[model samples]
Target chain A: MLFDKFKPMAEFQAELAARDVVPFGAVTEEIISATEGVVSGRRVILAGTNNYLGLSFDARCISAAQEAAGKWGTGTTGSRLANGSFEEHQALERELAAFYGVGHAISFTTGYAATMGMTATLAGPGEVILLDADSHASIYAGVQLSGAEIIRFRHSDPEDLAKRLRRLGDRAENTLIIVEGIYSMLGDVAPLREIAAVKREYGGCLLVDEAHSMGVLGDHGRGAAEAAGVEQDVDFIAGTFSKSLGATGGYCVSQHPELETIRYCIRSYIFTASSSPSVVASTRRALQILQEEPGLRQRLWENATRLYEGLQGLGLPVGPSPSPVVAVVLEDRSQAINCWNALMSAGIYVNLVVPPASPSTNFLLRNSVSAAHSTAQIDTMIAAYAGLLEDGLIRAR
Target chain B: MTQYQQYLEFMLSALEARAGAGVTLSETTRLVADIGLSSLEVMEFVEKIEDHFDISIPLNILPDINTLGDLARKLQEVDS
Candidate 1:
């Protein structure tokens, strides 16, 4: 049978069904209020969302989205190469390029496509791609599409990367090294300075995916590249609007004048429909908010530290640092599931990540902090976790 | 020892570092279940071998490889 090869997956699903825990495909009943939602018939605090700046429900952003939808209709209805590109889209691109202080910027439908399109088109035949071992799935998919030789250096180890690039020798000229600003699963930031140094010494293009770092790092929130003072060193910066921007789209900005060439070459850009008018409008407003209000970033980091310290105070295993994303490392899958269920029952929502997606073999309970979370809400979340620990629903390391 | 023999020994040493002291490794040993190397681990090991030999093995050659013997033979072929 055509489906016979997936017996193992079927068995796994059956096992999960018997356990009454379908961690995947969980549905939210409704979003009752900002940073509060109804899930599984209860009001839950949304601690697992990527709304870092918490601009998703901002009055200005909402108003812009509504006005844009009323003015330009909903979607572009065509690929950029055809009739999809609108004046608003180009304006957003210009705003983004100026935001990053780059010469050019290109927008895509989603952050995944930004990485996919840029990596897929940038490196060609006979070229090589050396990426961090713990890069996001979008990066892996992009490399696979490029049909270039893929080499993975040790995660965040510039020494290992240097060795690989040195081994490539003159072929390093055609090599593209990819890394991320903040790894989503573990919430660890990259050592961009070290990586940028390696790229400077070795002749290779450096692409930094700042999907999780933009609006969360640097004084101007340009991400790890700017935070590390290596903005000039990085050749390209890829980011998404879904997280901090409070919209749905992806963009790549570069100071390189040739970045315009990607518009004609990237398949993902040329084939798929552009972002909706509402999304572009809201994203532009969100960008303005991100810059104008630095307190949002400050409050976000404060909330992050509070949450990280709170989790640590409970003696639970946490990720390395206090970024917007805080991952609670678990010993096993059963333990992770139990903890997730317990948190859900307590009206606190968080994400449950397992193997393949997780950098290590262990499961992770990922909590993403936002600026909108009140001090009382943060304290409430901590108390819920404390209750879970007291009830023996979850364990400390 | 021949280059293939030396390479095999080096590969076995790297595997033992991860698999611990009691692992039984041979040229005919399956790199997956028998040695307990995940797909990602196998790829990393293959990359190490490529670096040691200063040869770029096409990614297409991966699936055809299962055992240490197969890897050694492929390395020899590429080097020659």
Candidate 2:
């Protein structure tokens, strides 16, 4: 009976197998560069990976990782509350805090853990969480585990948020408003300026998840809050090293002194092992590079605009705006699958998102552009989609 | 009218608007199986109900709801 719940997934897997199409989790045999990889015995452009700044293969980051590993051995071997509280972890925390100009910073083993821990622990039963309707799965999981009375507003609609807050009345002060800097699915930036204005009127703690927009937005690359000039109004800023920093970790920075105390109460942080020395080292190097080189961010935006314009020129249905993420919308699931397979055959790799996983009922062929992508690579991706359009695998809106 | 009855009436009209004018809707009418509402449609319907009642329904309650009666009763529980 417990296994019966997986029947739908099993059926889907069987269908894919029958079609000889592996859309999800296609393995990469070799990573030739930040922009290129070998998959299914064919070289393809790595467009689906969320390597926004493309510092994964940087020489400085690699050297820093090697040096840290040589000096500190391999893993931390324990949780931060136990024997895993190494000097490197604390240093990275301090560095993140300094980078955000916040009072406290806490790191987690994975980005999911950071968001989940913060969301679950920040508010408890008898409290409320007002989140965007199209929030990430991790945020949804956090709200469920928190036992909070969760309310979802229409996506990016500040008026809807204001209405919900009004309904809460005096209880609004006890609520936590969660929104992302750049929504991962559709590449739409949250109207943080309007959101912060609403928060000012309603009075609630604001938490912005800057996972996708941390290294891509803002003059100093802080995140959407910074770009919106609402950093002072935001109570907490959660972000990930896995995206822009090209490493594996997540963190939450806040100006409130209570975050230092809250870190001890987070079960995910206490129970999970700390990030390894090498990862911390590389992340530190990547953060430095992010600050030192503004050209990477510029290049990333240029590449994003190029890909978005290219698709739009071909009359493809793309996302609302062009950031580093550009997803083409599709109404037909089978047609989406066919286009994905065709792109792969044409030496390109992208993420195929279907219902529920996609923000809406429609499917999405998600592409994440990186600063490492050359102009040629961007054009090649465009040409592949054009071919799909020519072959009638996809149609314009 | 009882709160449950009011909720049922509202749900019936809503379902009728989507399913068709001549459709039948009872308290026991299944939302998905009988009326054929997709997940997105269900969420949209819930939002409409929330706005109508001026209530913030917790998403935690959706999984337990199968029929119009279940939704109405759950709505009454939240309203209380």
Candidate 3:
């Protein structure tokens, strides 16, 4: 038994099972139907997913991906160091760098990889990472991988950041300040302008992970940095093609030409296989469509606003305003599980996030609004939530 | 307040609040088999310490932590 060595995790596992929050993935839209699609059984609405842009099924994007595979073969077969850099990959990097209006950009195989490569490469032993308490697991894992001292401020509080930063004294110059454009679990925006101003005052570099917010924020969809009007001021912008672009991969763009220099030094990028040519190919097209079809941004905001309004009107614990993400906050873990299970049994699906994802237990019923979902689809979702409330399966906010 | 005394009161209130029910120990309490704190609750206690003392408690220090005094001693060391 690895239990002889790792005794405690098994205890945690038993707790998880008993809590009614199924740790295994079979409860909802990601359900397994034995090769038959859910349509043959019961139609399910996928709200728990992070498909913010909903371009995954776009005919053009899919066709372009298939076309690229025909042209470029299947896999890259190696890391980007040697035989892996495709015309698609190079072109995608160029398109992304131009998209963010930054001088250099590097793509990673996954959203996790982008964050790990930067945080681990930049900070090492004896250095510090000033992180938001609410930052994602990838960010936390990256800080751990970096071997840096991870210092946290209160969530989204720039005053806490400033005070904690002041404690590092002369070592502040060796600091990497990290925050999210929009926190994943909480569905809240950071005070980026205020946070950036403090980092600037203290002469620290800022790495903003716009994973959840990019292509959903700003009129132009540059991300929360642009939305906050600090695009030029931030040292690095790390975002996911997975979320807003409706594809899988991540990238970090920076004003520093030395940004590319980190690629050579970072182990995560150097060791792992590069993203498949098809993914890169699809993402490049997604970028083009992102700029051309600004109407998608408008539609996304419209859906998000509608959901926010519906939830708020229900007098639930919705987010403060028109965020692309909406969450119904709950306080008990069993209650959260009951609500999530009820949502699924009613053909609606949303993520049931619990702590360590957050401090609160019945934390969030996180639902994302996407461009592909129709007004009727959104209305159906709102109606389902209203029904959930009426059923008393999920408590009223 | 003695560092140990201040530590105990904070731990008692927060541990009682965050850990879901009353504890079976007092100021001299240890944090292992008696209470069965999940790793997360242990982390929460550490985070409370971090916030109270205005210091960064690296995650690496956690697995070895057992007794309340050990935690209090670590907090005092960090504070100094």
| DockQ for each model | 0.32, 0.76, 0.36
The sequence of per-residue lDDT tens digits that candidate 1 reaches over residues A213-324 is 9999999999999999999999999999999998899999999989998779998898899999999999999999999999999999999999999999899889887888
Docking class of 1: acceptable
TM-score of 2: 0.98
Candidate 2: which stretches are off by over 4 Å?
Answer: B17-23
Candidate 1 vs candidate 3, TM-score winner = 1
TM-scores, all candidates, are 0.93, 0.98, 0.88
**Deviation of model 3 at A358, angstroms:** 3.4
Answer with 1 or 2, whichever has the higher lDDT.
Answer: 2
CAPRI-style docking class of model 2 based on DockQ = medium
Candidate 3 lDDT tens digits, A1-397: 5558666556655766776445336433333321111421356666656777777777778888999899888889989998888778888888889988878999999999998788877888988888887788888888888887777777889988898788778888889999999887756888999998898878678999999988887768988889999887799999899987778999999999998788899788889888998999889888888889999888888988888898888778876667878888888766677777676666666777767676444467888878777787778878888887898756554
- Pairs in clash, predicted candidate 2: none
Candidate 3 wrongly placed segments (more than 4 Å):
A4-24, A27-40, B1-28, B32-54
Higher-ranked by DockQ: 1 or 2 = 2
Window of ten residues with lowest summed lDDT in model 1 chain A: A18-27
How much is the lDDT of residue A300 in candidate 2? 97
**For each candidate, what is the lDDT?**
0.88, 0.93, 0.78
